[model samples]
Target: MPLRALFGLLLCAGCAPLSAQDATRAPEPNTRVPAGVVRYAPSVFPDRIVLSPAQDAAHGFAVAWRTDATVAAPVLEIVTAGDSPDMGTPRQVRASSRELRTENGIARHHRADVDGLLADTLYAWRVQGGGTWSAWHHARTAPAPGAPLALLYFGDTQNKNVSLTTRVVREAMRHAPDARLALFAGDLVSGGDGEDDNEWGEWFEANESLPTSMAVAPAPGNHEYFEEFEDTPRERRVLGAHWPLQFALPGNGAPGAERTSYWFDYQDVRVAVIDGTSALDLGTAQAQARWLDGVLAASPHRWNIVVTHQPFYSPRAGRDNALLRKHLLPVIRRHAVDLVLQGHDHVYGRRLPGEAPTPVFVVSVAGAKQYRLSEQAQRTMRPVAEDTQLFQVVRIDGAHLRYEARTATGRLYDAFELRDDGSAKSLVDLPEGRIDERRCERAKTLKGRADRCWE
Candidate 1:
């Protein structure tokens, strides 16, 4: 393949335009696609079924789905998958439904919260919507307290979710089949308003069956918030209605930010999901900061991790999250967070803790969107990549945590280990058989456009 075409496929920088904040859409004009080519519409049957972790993943969990507005009464049936030939009797739970109007059409979102489940047990579930039953899917609860756990992390599957990003997610799953939870570091879709049903549909389709088996904890990004009105002189953006409607999240977040900002404990890990978009743009930064400090202060888990959309240290050139750095960074550093997983830079960067009680900060992207690395990133980040699609797998045991990053083709790109010494955590780089940092050569000028490289 030609360099530009290869770059187009590897880094989906060609799909949709970057976020609304970017001055230019796709820098390259030839990568644009027609609207009619992308088709991901809603249907009468239940689709886009996703599983989210409850506050206590071992004892409770939730599942959310979508269907036509006509499905008045949606139901979910779950049964324990035991060693016997026949599956055990199923328990039926009535799901709460809400009607939402979108660009595609009108659809109803149904969410069912299940509690009192046995810890570390596998359960088979199916949902009834549009008078049809979905295929039986399997999900496992978190292991017993202090038990070993594996987690899957992704940066931004924002652009070309179905066409290009699906392989990265699937390959990650194949690499860690036993992962219990997955964390999406915001920008799950490219739609700025976040109400585009086609984009949501494509994101759901891209994940395939991963959400069904492993619990997901997603943080909202700037792209998830859309302006309330396009013609209004003033800009007033609100959280997309589809965001809260599609995924059933824990309501244990701070006031004014319930589902978007919350925390959940899985096994020996406490994952704090923050609403960076709301905090930076919507005047809830201080509230979320207070809430985060409280959450981190009271955490009893062996390992504490924070996941958000914006990064304290951005990897892109001439980009920085001032508000996030001002409000959230101190709280994160004060609490001595173990890991900070962030996105929105469309590049890979990792910073290890030094003499200060700082956490291991990592910014990664799982989609095709690519960006130029900042000069600061070049000097600060030890191992970084550009124009590369990556996924992360983390395993946390009693006192040891293993982290690994791999490309879309399943090549180990970065690895590290952290061991807790009861007083503080120590990091050790695990760089064996890892590939060299990937970068593109600079080109003076392109035909008519100012300097641009082939990703």
Candidate 2:
């Protein structure tokens, strides 16, 4: 089949083509993350450290992490940092606790929602292991509502992630340490059986060091829901049973997908999250379809970013997610979304915002897994294939949003800027950097081992 067939059309149902963002020269090269951060112990287990979906309210942030049985009630504390180590003691804010368990056995995870915070303020935090603590990670929260912002996004983190994935994520953090929001659009694990559990652990440990001030908004990958079944297709399985307990989310559902699909307002941006599994596996799209339409209709925010696991449009050949496109694309278009993020293909992709006011749809992977693109891959701007590990940093400042995708070596791969001036187009390309084509064709299309690519 032709590559175009693999990804069905991703155009808006009734929207007309808006003018494209004037493609400008890429931004300057990003600096590397200091060596002090991104360090880990062989025995320390910090799988899947992350910021939750409920970050809209300025003073709040959420995080979750897993540990070896020896680690106690995993806790996170925030402290302020000065110009140098010579600076005085920092402020400390601890997250209230909710203990969670891993379906794979033995490994327990910690989920915390930190509220009552200050906006655009610099703070350092550490995830505590019993009496001891993880590294002193640093970050800042989103600007006050109606303020401009920036964000970074990644797709899947599903592979030999224990040691490798950290560098890719750190690369993004180094580019913009105070990043306001980070989006993980699924496949954070492999999700088949053993791999899903293990990879989630690795993925968490990978990012715990950088979320000091920035917040992350993640969607559950399809692998997150692989529980067994008795009737449906006999071979197919339901999503896993442990997701709800793993992370505490805002129960703000659209209409039908209460916990599975939800939305929250972050300052000037209203981000919506969904579980494609519910829509695809069960006939629940009707409810979420209505819910999404309502959420968008009710949104008063200046920006909208939708988070899902399946791409409305695929970057590789032979992959199809038509059902999702049928139910959600029209809604996304009608809402005039600014961004739609997903991961299934282990690559980096961004579609300049749209047939509507929305300008970009991106897919990024943080795990060790990578995939190949088609001959016309260049036609897909900022398409980074298998072999190269990467992550993005998106900062929203005033009316403009700046984004930089940094490679594992801390080099800027691609950068763009978007403005909210009611213009149809908004992608400002970077000036110069390495575009690793080394692993461009790392793996053939759909190699059946996508399972290995996860936990």
Candidate 3:
């Protein structure tokens, strides 16, 4: 974890080569296993079942899964849960299936829409892979309009130690069992564009409960993009090979930003996922900017939440996303976005609640990767954490939004409340006992040790 190695790791998404001083540093560990060698085996069972919010969550939901090539026609069996003990017969919905070839092998990806669902009602569903069937899973649709809601937010759970990262996700879920939605602010895997099936598998396995129950909303991060060759740098990169096939997202977004950048409403909150990487690299910034304006202007929800991989107000020095700030921040501010959740800096940071119109900007990390806090971060953000893995839970009720950040060990690290009046809003910092910040002296000593760090 020398300075050179740190720079290489931080700039890996841009495909930057390691410096000469980093040549002797140990290579980052690869966590993929043989079992993750994505291959197709025609079995009756389906895997990777994920549930996502449709444009209209009250009356619709989307499900996506993977099956072997033999499963020519994938199907979903869904039914309303009965009041009594006996379960009723389910109506079958045929799913659209597609073949996706990856470095591991070829597999069939299937997706289906469940429409006309009763609002706030319990429903059971299962997927069919040829003659095989998955276990019945249940999920609840969004409640009546304006009802109170809670959700969990996670930052980058990207690489090397998924086992360690999975625990944090599970712990967050355990702490917020009532949460109806889970938001992943990008970089679900270390080598998404490279088709690292093992890393993808580990990520999927880590959140087994979410896909079956809670609706998942994910944004794409720079690491999610991979170049044609590992050593080629960032000259050529594309969205991860697994993205489109892995999640069924809303299509109402910028023409080219479907699935990756979209907006959906749940109860009183409108959550918008913006494609920061696309804006930064693909020249989709203007399109997304206009779409964002329209989405927010048209939203009737009580709270507006925006999720992106890169922070407009960067928490790390020498990592400012000025382009994003210039193109998207104005729109975010104009719309009075209530909360902006972000990742990619590998640290936890929050700009103290300020004057009117400025949304709560937060950058956090939930994986094992750690980064040092910069002078700019220390000077601007209060209650920032370096070398700490954290998760957030947000609850929305009428005009009030409550946010809490917690460590992997269930310690409360940060908390705040944002209350909206008819015309403007107010911010209140919630006091909590937090662990002492990890400093450079201790961090430098831990470099290349169990916990990677350096100055």
Q: Using lDDT as the measure, which candidate wins? A: 1
- What lDDT does model 2 reach? 0.62
Q: What TM-score, over all chains together, does every model reach?
A: 0.89, 0.72, 0.88
- Candidate 3's TM-score reads 0.88
**What are the lDDT scores of the predictions, listed in order?**
0.83, 0.62, 0.80
lDDT of 1 by residue, 75-125 (tens): 999999766657978999999999988776788899999999999999989
lDDT of 3 at 125: 90
The worst-scoring run of ten residues by lDDT in candidate 2 lies at 14-23
Question: Which regions of candidate 2 are displaced past 4 Å?
Answer: 1-55, 63-112, 121-140, 146-148, 211-213, 230-236, 352-357, 374-386, 422-455
User: Taking the tens digit of each residue's C-alpha lDDT, what string does model 3 give over 1-455?
Assistant: 46755654453333333445445555445464544444433344688889999988888889999877778777899988776656887989899888876655667889998898889988989889877789888899999777889899999988754567778988898899999999999987778435466677677777767779889999999887776565655566688767888898888878667757999989988899999988987888888998999999999887889999999888776787888888888999899898999999888899866566459899999887777677788988888987788899999888888999999988898888888887778888888676666443232212343123321
Models, CA RMSD each:
5.6, 10.4, 5.4
Per-model tally of clashing residue pairs: 1, 45, 1
